[model samples]
Target: MPDTKPALSKVSVMQDLLKVVAPYRWRIAAAVVLLISAKISTVLVPLLLKRIIDALSQPQTLKALPIYLLAGYALLRFSSTLFNELRDLVFSRVTQRTVANYAQMTFEHLHLLGARFHAKRRMGGLLPDIDRGTAGIAFLLGVGLFTLVPTLIEIALVLGIITSRYQAWYAGFIMLTFLVYTGFTVVFTARRTIHQRRVNRLDSSAKSRLADSLINYDTVKYFTNETVEAQRFEEIMRHWTEAAVANQKALFTLHVGQSAIIACGVAAVMLQAGSDVMAGRMTVGDLVLINAYVLQVCLPLNALGFVYREARDAWVNAERLFDILHERPEMEESRGMPALSPGRGEVVFEHVSFSYEPSRPILRDVSFRIAPGATLAVVGGSGSGKSTLARLLLKLYAPAEGRILVDGQDIARVSATSVRSMIGVVPQDTVLFNDTIGYNIAYGRVGASQEETVGAAKAAHIHELITTLPGQYDTEVGERGVTLSGGERQRIAVARAVLKNPPILIFDEATSALDSASEHAIQQELNRLSHNRTVLMIAHRLSTVVDADEIIVLEQGRVIERGSHEELLGKHGAYARLWQLQQREDMDQRAAASRA
Candidate 1:
C-alpha cells in the first residue's frame, strides 16, 4: 500500500550518474589531470624535506642553508594546494549542472505523472526526498570523485616509492595495515548503513507529519485538536531522534576503530625505522623519510574510511531518486502521435467502464453523446460516477472496457496533450496556486495578455468583485486560494475555463458554491459560453440543468433515465424524485427567509 517504489541498486545509481556526467567528460578529464599533478607535487614535498634533513645533519653540507632545496620545498607545497583548488574550480560547473539537470527532470516528470500517482503522494515527504537526492548527487560528484580517486592514486604512488627506495618490510607493513583498515571500515560501515537508512525514513516521516499538520491547521483549530496534532508530530520526531542516536553511535564506533588501527600501524612502522637506524643499516635521513611516508599513507587511509562511508550514504539517497525516475507513467505518450484534428465539438462515449480497483467499480456500461454545439447534463447523487464521466472525457484515465471519441476520432489514438487542449474543465473543488489572481487566471492559457485575462474575468462575472479589492487582479490568493471564499475560488475556476475557450467544456458543479443571485448570473454566462460548443454539465442542483438539451439520470454508475427535463418529470422516476425534493427545500428556504 506504500506509494514508494523499490530503491535502485548502487550499480544502477552509478550508471545513471555517469550518464548525466557524460556530457561533461572533457571537463572531468581535465580535473583528473590536475588531480594527478597535485598528488605528484604532494609526494615530492616530503622527498625535498628528507634532503633538507640529511643536509642539515651532515656538518660538511650545512653551508648556504640549502636555499634552493628550501625554496623547492615551499614551492611544491604551494603547487599542491594550487592544483587542488584549480581542479575544484574546473569541475564545479559539472557538479552544479548535473544537480540542476536531475532536479528539473524530476520536477517535469512529477507533472507528467497521472492523478492517481499524485493523489497517493505526500508533498511533505516527497520534497525532502528530492532535496536529499540532489544533494547526494553533488556530494558524490565533488567529494567522491576528488577524495576517493585522489587518495587511491596517492596511496599507489607512496607504496611504489617506499618499495623501491626502502626495505621491503616497510612497504609490506603499510600494505597490510591498509588492507585491515579497509576491511574494518567496510564491515562497520555496512552495519552503520542500516542505521542510516532507518534514520532517513523516520526523518521523512516526521517532516510529513509536520507538513500535514500545518496544512490542515484550520481543521485542527476547528475541532480544538491542536494538542492531538502536537502529540502525533511529537511521536514521529521521537522515533527520528532515536534512530539518529543509533546512527551516531555506529559512526562513533567506526571512527574509533579506524583511529585505533591507524595508530597501531604508525607505531609499528616507526619502531622498525628506529631499529634500522640504530643498527647502521639506515641513516637518520632514511628514518625521517620512512616516518613521513608512513604518516602520509595512514592519514589518507583514515580519510578514505570516512569518504567510503559517506559515499555509501550518498548511494542510498541517489537510489531513492532514481527509483522515481524508473517508475512507469500511468499513460505513455508515444512519439509522433497525431494531433486531434479541429472540428465541431461532438463527443461520444460507448459502453465505457472504469474502476479505481477491481473490487470497486466507479463507472459501468456508460454510454452518451453530445451533439456539436449542444449541452448534455448528467445528474446523480454522490458516488454515482457523474464526475468520472468528465474525467474519462478529459483523458485523465483510460477506459477499462470502451473507447471515447471526440469529433469522430478515438481519443486514445491521439496525444493526450492534443485531447486536453481541446477541452476545458471547472472542477467542484477549485484549488488555485499561491499566486496573484491574474497569474491563476492566465494559467488557463499560458502567456495570455493582461487584456485577455481581464476580459475572461468579466465573462465569469467576477470582474467587478476583483476591482473592489485593493490589489485587484494582482491580489494574492494564499495557499490553495484559502484567502478567498469558496464562491470566490469557484468564480476563478470558471474564469479559467472561460479564458481557455476550448471546443468542449466540463463544468463539474461549477456553480455549486455561489449564492443564488451569483449562481443565476454565472449560470447565464455559462449558457452563453456553451453556445456553439459541446458541453458536459455535472450538477447536483436540478434548477441549473433544466434547460439542458438532454438529461441523463445516473444511479450507481448506470443510466436509469434519459430524456428532456420535462419528459423525465412526466415519467416520475429518479429525476422526478430529486426535482421534487429540491423544490420543497427551495420553498422551505424561502419561507424561512420571509419569517426572518
Candidate 2:
C-alpha cells in the first residue's frame, strides 16, 4: 500500500544534500567558479544600458553609440556562453556519477538484507521510492543547488550594484518589497507541489503492487480470488486519485497567487522609476536599467519555487531508500565460525527448540540424529514442525535452543554461507530465475562446465526437453519459469540439486503436487540422487518414501516414532495407520479413473 504521509521536507532535504555531492566536491567547486563568472557577464549587461543612455543624452559625439554597445554586448554574451558550456559539462558528469553511486549502494544493501526483511516490506513501498529518491538527488544537486544557487547569488549582486550606483533608499525599497513578494509565492507554491509529489508517490506504489499481483495471476485464478484482489486494488487506486485531486487543487491556488505577486512587483518597480525620471531626479538611462534589472532578478527568485518542489520530493525518496540501506541483516554468526568441509553429512538435532516468535514455538525441544548416508523420512500433518526441522538443519533459521551438529561441529558455529553451500534443498513450489536453461542448471557453482550442466540435466530427465527446444540449453525460461509445466519446473529443481552435488539433500514435498507419471519419473531420479548423501525427505505421499532407511514420525512438534516402514507396520502404530490411509487414497484415485 502507498504510504499516506510525506516523510520529509525540502528545507530538511537540502541540509544533507552535500553528502551526495561530497565525492565530486572538487569538480563541483570548479564548475561553480565557471557558472558564477558566466552569471556576472549576464548581470553586467543591464548596467551597460545606463552607459548607452548617458551617451545618447550627452552632446552627439559621432553617435559611436550603437556600434560600441553592440560590440561590448556581443563579447559578454560570448564569454557567458563559453563558461556556461563548461559548467554544464562538469555538472552533468558529477550529477550522473553521484546518482549511479547512490543507486548501486541501495541495490547492494537490499541483496544483503536477507529474506525476513523482504517478507515484511511491500514492493509498493520500495521500488518507486528508491527510483524517485535517486532521481531527486540528481535534480537537487545538479540544478537546484548548482544552477539555482548561482542564480540567487547574481540577484543579490544586482541589488548591491543598485544600492551603490543608484539611490540607496530606492534600492532598499525594491529589495525589501521584492523579497516579500517572492518569499510568499515560494512558500505557497511549495505547499501545493509538495502535496502533489506525495500523491504521485502513493499512486506509483499502488500501480507497482497491482502489477505484481497480475504477474501471479495464476495463483489468483486457481484460488478463485480474482474478484477479491481486483477489489483490493481498486480501493488503493481510489485513495490515490483522491490525494492527487486535492494536490492539484492546492497547486492551482498557488499558481494564481504567484503570478499576481510577480506581475505587481514588476509594475510597481517600473512606475516608481518613471516617476523619479519625470521629477528630473533620475536620468533616462536609470529607467531602462531598472526595467531590465528587475526582470533579471525576478527570474531566479521565481525559480526558487520549482527548486523547492524538486528538493522536497528528492528527500522523501531518500528517507525510504536509506531505510533499506541502513537496515541490519538477519542475525549472522559474527565470531567463532568453524570451517565447513565435507564430512559424515551426519545431522544431529539435540534438544533443538525454535520459534519465529517467543512463547510461540514451532519445534519444542525436538531431538533426533541421522548418520551419514542415511535416509531420514519426516512424516507429519501441516504445522507439525516437520519442515521446520529440515529448515533448521539447513540453517535457514537458527534454533532458539539446543544445537544441530554436522560432522561433529554445531551448524551454528559454522559460516552460514559455507554450510548452505554443501546442502541442496528441493522446495514444494519450485522457483526458477528468469535465465537460460544452461545458466539455471549451472547456478550451483559459479564456474561449472557445460558438460557438468548437461550431465546433471540428463540425470534429472530434462536434457531431452532442452535439446528439443531450438536453442537447447540456451532457451530462456520465462518469469519464475511460468513457461514450463509444474513437472518441468520440479525436474529443473532436481537438476540444480544434481549439479550442486551437496553432501546433504532435502526434498520437502518435492513430488507431492505432480501427476502420477511425473511423480514416478522424479521419484526414480530422486532415488539415484540420494545414493551417497545424507537425505531428508518430507512427503505427503507416504508410498514414495516406503523404502527410506528410517522414518521419524512427528506429532505437534514432538517426534513420537522412529523406524523403517516394516518395523513401524509391525508395531501397528502411527506409521501403520498412515500407510493404510495412503492405500485408501490410492484406491480412491483408481476408482475415480475407472468411473471416468
Candidate 3:
C-alpha cells in the first residue's frame, strides 16, 4: 500500500532522486558546471564592490577602476543569464525523458497484470498514484537538482568568503541566526503542515473522481441514484476543504515566520557593516559589497525552503515509479515451444478442472471434444461455468488440473499467440474503441484494406448500415460503440471475426443481444462463416443454436445431456427443461404481438 502521508520535507527525498539523474551523468555534469559558474558570478559582485571602494580610497588608482568594474559586472551578469538558460534546457530534457519513461513503464505494468489484480483495485486509488508520480517529476527537477543542491553550494561559498575576508563573527552571526529561525519554524509548524499536504492529495483525487462521475452522468441518471451520488460527492468535497484549509494555515505560519527572520537578518548584517564603515576599515562601496553578499546568501536560503517542499513530494513519486520499472510479468514464455502446424481445429478438454479460488471449483472434471470442422453448442444457465470453459480453452485462465489439447498437441506446449490466432473469438462484450468503423472491422486482420473490410461487413449484413452513416466506413464508433445500437455493435464484432478467418471460431453469445430480424440475418452470416471451420459456441437463446450438430446441456459444471434439440427433448433432462422454457417464452411474445 502507498503511504498517504503528505511528504513533509524535501531534505530526505532528494538524496535518492540524484541517483535517477545518473544515466545522463555527463549532461548533468555540464549543467552543474554552468550552475557553478553562474553562482561564482553571483557571489563575485560583492568582492568587485569592495575592490572598487578600496581603489576609491586611494586617489592614485581611482580613474580607471569605476569603468573597469562596471564593464566586468555587466559581463558577469550576461554570462550568468546565458548559463542559467543552458542549465534549464539541459534539466528540461532530463526531466521530460524521465517522466515519459516512468509513465510508460507504469502503464505497461498495469496492463500486464492479471484480471485478479484489477478486480480488487479501485480506479481512483490507482489513478491518483500515477498522477502523484508524474507530478513529482516537476518537483524533483526544480527542487532536487536545481534549488536544494545549489543552495548548499551557495551557503558553503558565502560563509567561506565572509570569514576569510572579514571575521568568523560575520559568518557565525548569519548562519546561527538563519538556523535558529528555520529550526523554530519547522519544529512548531511541520506536523500540522504535512497533514494538510496529505489532505490536498486526497482532495485533488476527489475532484478527478467527480469529473469522471460527471462524464458518466448518463449511467448515474439511468440508475436513478442522482441524490445518493450527489451527497457522496459533497461529503468527499467537504473533507477536502477541511484538509486544504489546514495546509494553508501551516504554510501561512511558516512564511510569516520566515519573513520575520529575513527582516532581522537584514537589519543585523547592515548594522555590522555600518559599524565597520564608521571605523575607517570599510568605505561606502564596502558596505554595498557586504549588502550584496547578504542578499546573495538569502536568495539560496529562501530557495532551500522551496527545495524542501517539493523534494518531499518527489520522493513519494519515486517509490511508485520504481515499483513499476521493477515489476516482472508472470507466465514467462517457454524456451522450446515449436511453431504449431496449420490448425486442424480439433480441440479436446481432458478432465479439465479449474477455479478462480482454491476452495471452490468453477469447472470440475469437465471434459468435451469437438471433431475437426464440427459445430458444437454449449448451453447452461448463469454461474454454470459456461464462460469459464471458454476462458480455459482460450488460455486466459489455465486449468488447475488436467489438460487441454489442440490438434493432438498440449495447449500449454504451443505458443499462446499461435493458439489464439487459430481460434477467433466474438466475445460476449462487443468492445469497440473510439476509431473509424473501417479500422475497427480491419483490426481482426492487420493490413486489411477497404475492400476486405466491406466484404466482411457485407457477410455480417452490416454493409448497408455502414453506407447509411455520414462517413460510411470512416465513421467513428464513439466510446465503446455508443454511436451504434447493440445489435449493430454485435454485427460489427461478427464481421471482425469473419475477417479473421481463423481455423476455429468461438461465438460466446454472439447473437444474444440482436432482435429477431437482426439475429435472423446474422444467423445466416454465422452459418456461412462457420463452414469448414470448427465452431465451439455458447448461446442463451435456444432458437439460434437449435440446428447445431451437437447441443451439450451443462448444469453445475457437468455435462448432463448431449444430443440434437429433438434428441435432448426426448431424453427429458436439463436440456429438455431449458428448451421447453424458451419455447413457452417465444410463444407468449408472439401471442401478445398478435393480440396487440
**For candidate 2, lDDT tens digit of each residue in 1-596?**
34333334334444445666687878988998998999899888887867877777785574454777878978888898899899989888888888898898888878767666777777766777788778877876787786578767887888888888777655665576567766876677567656766686777668676877888888998999988888888988888889888887886776666667767778888888899899998899888898888888777666765566556556554666655665777855676676676687988889988887786778887787778998999997888888887778777778788999888888787888778887898888988889988888888666899999999999999999999999899999988888889999999899999999999999999998999999999999999999989998998888888989998888878888888988988989988898899899899999999999
Name model 3 segments beyond 4 Å from true.
1-23, 53-61, 121-128, 177-197, 204-216, 261-268, 317-342, 413-415, 564-566
Q: What is the per-residue lDDT of model 1 for residues 1-596, given as tens digits with 9 covering 90 to 100?
A: 34233333556667888999999999999999999999999998888899988888896856577899999999999999999999999999999999999999999989888878888998888898899989988998999889999899999999999899988899888998999999999999999999988988887788888899899989999999999998988888888889999999999999999999998889899999999999999888888888888888898898899889998898777766777877778987889999999888999999999998889998899999999989999999999999989888888889999899999999999988999999988887899999999999999999999999999999888899999999999999999999998778877887898899999999898888778977887788788888888999999999999999999999888999999999999999999999999999999999999999
Off-target runs (Cα >4 Å) in candidate 2 are 1-21, 56-59, 63-68, 177-194, 197-201, 219-232, 332-342
lDDT of 3 by residue, 1-596 (tens): 34433343233334445665679888888888988888787777678767766677787856554887878877887887888888988777788876776677678778766556665555665676677777787667754677767777877888888888886667877897679766855564556546655775675568666766876878999999889878888888888888878777877777777777877887888898899989977778768877888888776676676566556546555555555544554444566777567868998989988778888778778788889999899999987788787787777767888999889888877766778888888877798989999999999898998899999999888999889989999999898888888888888888899899999899898888778887787778888888999999898887878888898888777887888888988998888888889999999999999999
lDDT (C-alpha, whole model) for all candidates: 0.90, 0.81, 0.78
- For candidate 1, what is the TM-score? 0.97
**What is the model-wide C-alpha lDDT for candidate 1?**
0.90
Clash pairs for candidate 1: none
- lDDT score, candidate 1, position 179: 97
Please give the clash total of every predicted structure, in order: 0, 0, 1
Best by TM-score: 1
Q: Model 1, which residues run further than 4 Å from truth? A: 1-8
Ranking by TM-score: 1, 2, 3
